[model samples]
Target: MELDYVVGQTLAWLRALGIEKDTFVFFTSDNGAARVSDVPVPGGGSNGPFLCGKETTFEGGMREPAVTWWPEHIPAGTVSQQLGTVMDLFSTSLSVAGFSVPDDRLIDGLDLSPVLHNNTLINRPIFYYRGNGIMAVRVGLYKAHYWTWSNSWEEFNQGINFCPGQEVAGVTTHTQQEHTMQPLIFHLGWGPWEKYPISAVTTEYQDALSRITAVVEKHKKGLVPGVPQLNMCDMTWLS
Candidate 1:
């Protein structure tokens, strides 16, 4: 209700100022809902049919719906399945403002103007990173889990379970487990919830793995390590 009211008021203001057609509004979430146990509901929050919530590399943790609004420029009631990330906002805004993105540094974001304007599909792979480590990658309709870890156990010890009753064996784990040698591949088209993993002996598995491996190798070859920020801490209080 509050969100609806805020959006309504914002749009009303834009219309009042006669700038609604010129303004571009992009709505999205940083991550999936946090499902803790302290809330009034049995499960704190819902991530729909996806398994687990924020802090994991599962679909529930990262998959989010995005809404883009531009009066005459973007068609209304149109939906796009093109892959996009929050980072694209940077490039998209730059393109909209008649500015070019900096070319000196590596920019992982792609301009989403085509998708917004014509609902065109862009074929690109998305790499899911968790604290500087690549946990998963998705290309087209298939997703490969290179590493699997969930905080449900950690939260459960603290009286919460993010996954609740939807935990799948060998996919969700308490500790970080590497699947580099044999990544767990899932056809998101068939099961977006990631319940079924392709059998290693199957031809589909081989084809998917071959494509994923090539992308991963190319990514690693051009990767540049940055300073770690998550581990930084201040000890001034101890003095």
Candidate 2:
């Protein structure tokens, strides 16, 4: 209730300052809002429609909310599903303030001035490597999470085990769930991808899997090429 109250007070202040009209005030959430509000485990309500939230290398952990307000410049009640990144904020603000995006600095994010000024969309890929060897490659509307969480160095083929409901530490409200690269690749729209309900993978879906997996396999090898524990994690599959 404290943060909620602070949010209201902040809004009132902005409204009084008239910055509400000329400023772009953006509010969003990461790793999907907690389903259980605050608890730890696989029991929290998933932001589903996109699998596994927060920790798991699923879409639920990746896609986040984006809401902006700029009464003087941005049209009121405008909801654009334009893709952007939280990492782009600093550069976006600098560019909006008419500053340059320093080429010398290794800016990992892009400038989002286009999204605000020209109402353009961000067209780029975003990747996230999760605990264990699990990782995801997000490109526009298509996202591919590789379930390669491993247990050993020279033996990646043995691979990490897949279980949809495993327990995690620290973060409350997010519970573990089974994750298998095979199931995900074959049925991404379901399970870890959660875009589709069960029993709904069409022929077109199968074809898409073949196409995407081909690319993943090309970039991926069968063994861990780095330090075992530091490079990977133990998800009850291997430690």
Candidate 3:
């Protein structure tokens, strides 16, 4: 574990630098363990608790691990599940280094120095997106998975053969039904591995045709008028 190893080495380095045990060491990752195969496991990497491989914007693929350490100055033997992002690390390290955000540069990350020093929670608003799709947004305990579009073209964007229940690009776009599918939403607290059509049990599912029609009606001039849009691909977990 990089986190564990870094914790040990930081202590050694602090002593070498004569910084004393009061020196702090911060640790984190770009994202949750969504590594395709960075771990040395026989099969896939250890994104344990999350589902599928990375590149498909999901909880397992996005949420990363974050940590901070200081032998004497920071609280010992404590862990907190604070929801933060990679951008937070820049501001955090800057603060720990006694630096300030530049007046001209724009920043989208939160400063997590308080959490590092006092164990305060910095978990707050967050959003996930893939392409133009606003995949999910987090608000406290409620996580809304919005399927803004519908399954169309049956086939992926290739426009030759239809999707055949295989992972295309990264979106999964296949179902048992012959023609129709539905948008799905899941409560993220449950891990979201078993996402299915909104009405997976029922014969009726939302028609990609209808969804397309609705979009065209809402924005008539911009549905790529007069051209067939059959190559539309829908985003999902299983292809």
Candidate 4:
């Protein structure tokens, strides 16, 4: 695959430059793989065992495949299930470079050096946003879905149509509608295929929900009003 070739070259280049040990290379996709129905068959990408695929706030959409490379910094053959986001790169890179993040601004990213260096656990809740609105949040092993949508274009019925016994090929129709309702809770530790509601069954659900709700409230309090800017000068090439 092209991705494989590119990554191989990247590592090779880093090794040649003698900076592979010092450089931090994080390889990951922006979202999960495309569903089988969305792409052409014979080589259609799978979202693995996750519920849905790209373009939705499901675990499949938010949980992406990632690989971090830092030869001497990050331990080899070590895998961390730590919760992290792309936003953390800003602060993490700065920290690794020995620079301080600005104290005047709200930084949603926590320093991931500890997690990478010592395998520390990060219990922060990751708020999943679809555009300007918050769709869901995941803290620890629990995830709360406040909004719902099917991964593929076929919508809610796609699951039934694409299952093992009920497999239907080349079905593309927009029959699902966006939905808003009470939050649906899931414990990801239970496994990717377990989507059953366990809020009533587990006492930790309400406590975790309350903590996540507070996180949202604290985030709201940190919001700063935006000020529009305009360019007043024109630039010309200098002799």
Query: Which candidate leads in TM-score?
Result: 1
Better of 1 and 4 by TM-score: 1
Clashes of 3: 8
Candidate 3 residue spans exceeding 4 A from truth: 1-7, 20-23, 32-42, 131-133, 147-185, 190-239
> Which candidate has the highest lDDT of all?
1
Clashes per prediction?
0, 15, 8, 0
Q: Which rank order by TM-score, best down to worst?
A: 1, 4, 2, 3
lDDT of each: 0.86, 0.54, 0.51, 0.67
Q: Among all windows of ten consecutive residues in candidate 3, which has the lowest summed lDDT?
A: 161-170
RMSD, each candidate, Å? 2.4, 9.3, 11.4, 6.4
Work out the TM-score per prediction.
0.92, 0.61, 0.57, 0.78
Model 4, span 53-147: residue lDDT tens: 56656666668867889988888999888888888888988988889998997787888878888988876678888766777777788777666
Stretches off by above 4 angstroms in model 1 are 39-41, 152-154, 227-231, 234-239
Worst 10 residues of 2 by lDDT: 167-176
Put down candidate 3 lDDT per residue, 1-239, tens digits, no spaces.
Answer: 98569777867777898885656566656554433332333233445555444454455566666556666666777787677777777787788879996767556677888877788886565656566445555544334444322233543243322112223332344332222133343345553542432343543323433443354344333323233444355434335
TM-score result, candidate 4: 0.78
lDDT value, residue 24 of candidate 3:
57
